[model samples]
Target: MSNHRQAKDPRLQKISSQLAAHGLILRGGFVFGDGEAALEPSEARPAKSVLLVGQAGAAPWPYFLGWREQQPRDLQNPLDTWSREVIDMVAAHFSAWTVYPSDKPYQPFQQWAMRAEGLKPSPLGILMHPEYGLWHAYRGALLFADEIPIPDIHDPIHLCDQCVGKPCLKSCPVDAYSGDGFAYQSCLAHVRGTDGEPCRAGGCLDRNACPYGTGYRYPADVQAFHMASYAGL
Candidate 1:
């Protein structure tokens, strides 16, 4: 596709509205460059007209549970269906496009979001949605061909600040989280040695203890997948 600039497109607004109706929230920003080059404009990639990111909530939890129990041959079939629906809606507005889901490997994302954009490294256990807590996961991202108005970036709500119980910090059996940061090695060793015994049985106590995300809880299997990957198992 030509990199020529185009006028602001009305279809972008319509697409965002449609996605919101489908329960997907949108965030927009341009991707940046790698490392120190990130601070310099010369290192930047061609600014895409606009980028769309979508987040889904606890609505998919029960489906995830059923799929895990059934162990379907195509594990991702259901998620793929959901992702495709969103992508199609975005394609209606943009000609050339790219879509990314959270289940994809994290390395590329780190490079793209941090190194490229010059964004600071995300906190060890920080989850995206404040209201949903860590229970929610990003479903997909869409890129467009024309600049679209983006919502203002809001300060992340630090639910931990107001939490009285502080269950997430105390719930980990291994005490993997310190008030300052995560005890990465301790958490990894515990998960690997025990085959994720405690976590697989009851999910990550830390994540489960978050009171804010009661409605956006992830399915047990989804939580397991994330824990297993974190443990490198």
Candidate 2:
């Protein structure tokens, strides 16, 4: 594929459209340096652009829940399984190389998101979205040998800046979140104990406290599902 063909490629529009049905969308994309492209040595294609595809808020939870229900009961990591299947289908549709953040080699997704989307990190370490807050997630990416026409990204205005007081840091009952960082063990223990009832029944208070994207907050059931997973239940 050549740069001249990219602007006219019908597949580009199809890829974006079809993915929306599965609640996936192209988060961002960027041209890469030759050296950066070499990061995925397993893939033979010299990547022209790395496209960040992801889920925003609970957009994918419904589709994923439905997908998991049809699978065998013994299935573990149902969300991961469903996401990989969705991502694989889209990758094939566009003839792009597939990569997941959860892959063993761990693709440099943070770098990819930073470059592709011009995203900056929030207090919780999750990359904050101006519109989505911490309610979004990068499920996978598509690496293409030829550039794909994509919208230009602008520097984001981090919502954390406008926050008068960082509620996310103070909302956790156990102080699991702070400027210092998350207390992984403390958080897990608290969420598993009687005191964790609020978090378990709803979701992480710290995450939910973010003012930017409350309208995009995951449904209670979705949040509970994630909390269950977080508790390793």
Candidate 3:
């Protein structure tokens, strides 16, 4: 894939290099000709293609963490700020627009990933990546007015289907991660209370329990950084 693009296309390489400098990578993407079915029409624009760009492992954390230190303590949503700036710069360079996962009238990034990256859901409902498992995330996307030849999407290797016992379903003490749905209230209560130290400091227990992509798990400090933000600390 890399060689094919490098030989015939300079555009992908431009994007690839820009993202890599910040320790981010293009996760997967789709050419949104008619707009993805899951995307709310009111929220989506008439874009010819969508590039589902994101981080694959711990590569982006150092960029985020180091950048955060230079921000004011009272600065809000620093991670989102970092993502928006990085993606906006790249998109602008290519004469495209940027969208974020946390944007209002949210874009259907999950569907885009499924169509572009061949990702499936894990028991925790996070997109189960064959390589990065639950630790990966979609930071943002780039939308272009012109279509590019996107990589084909193959059937996702549903790792959760092959597991003996779904550890993520059982790892949360409150059973907040059961198949029914996440118990958001219960989870928030726990993370805000005294016994929440484990989760509050190092990320969700259930997410960490996933057996696949152990090598790609976010480093301890990075985990702690996000956990602290999630807990509003």
Candidate 4:
């Protein structure tokens, strides 16, 4: 007897369910046709697929801290390990895979999924998990053989609606995040400046003020690393 499984296998559903149980959310979409065009001058192609982004929830924070803090000297190792595990799992469910930072210029795979299926950005970002406050990130993504079914993209709920203090836009010592948009250069200057302030010593003041994801927040060092990376330091 021979094992017979369809190429577009239903087993993917089981795998996805398992991932969800582990706090990883699966998002599907097509590979952007202009992958090379989206690359930055200093950045290399990170992967070669449409992308399936996975993010673990706040429930994983304790586990995340175990690797993120205790092994501070080897931070990248654990992050890389977890990210690759997600990539591999997604790849198994899809035809191809690619992993990149969500902050990258490349269109979000969720947006791509919508466009491919004739959709729009609605009001909110995709996968409207109520707690992450747009702070959660896409750790890795995978590309697939066919389009996957996703909830009709809805408008993102403006977190500002519920935030009484709106601290994220106000906590910045330099007011980097305006109600309208970010003052990227100003933020970078403040973080890297010789002000010798608590923001520099701790992490992004604006990000820390986000009321959501209080439990899932990135460790301070991780926040600093990301802020420094954004500052091009």
Q: Rank the candidates by TM-score, best first.
A: 2, 3, 1, 4
Badly placed stretches (over 4 Å) of model 3 are 1-9, 35-45
Error of 2 at 186 (Å): 0.8
Q: Per-residue lDDT of 40-86 in model 1, one digit per residue for the tens?
A: 11234333443545455555445444545755655555555656666
Worst 10 residues of 3 by lDDT: 1-10
The sequence of per-residue lDDT tens digits that candidate 4 reaches over residues 18-129 is: 5665466655433334434343223343333343555634444444556456555635446556666656755665445454554356545555544433333212222333
Off by over 4 Å in 1: 1-45, 60-89, 99-124, 153-157, 229-233
**What does the lDDT read for residue 56 in candidate 4?**
37
The lDDT leader among the candidates is: 2
lDDT of each: 0.55, 0.82, 0.79, 0.53
* CA error at residue 81 for candidate 1, angstroms: 10
Candidate 4 ranges with C-alpha deviation above 4 Å:
1-12, 17-24, 27-51, 57-89, 99-105, 108-129, 151-157
Clashes of each: 2, 0, 0, 9
Worst 10 residues of 2 by lDDT: 1-10
Tens-digit lDDT track for model 2 on 53-163? Answer: 898889988888788889999888888889889888888877787888889788789988987788888888888888888889899988888766665667989778888
- TM-score of each candidate? 0.60, 0.91, 0.89, 0.59
Off by over 4 Å in 2: 1-10, 41-43
lDDT tens digits, residues 1-233, model 3? Answer: 22113132357779989999898888766565443443423346567667878887788888887888999988888888999989888987987787898888777779878878888888788899888888788888887766666655668788988998888877776788775788988988898888888887778889999899998998877888887887677
Report model 1's TM-score to 2 decimal places.
Answer: 0.60
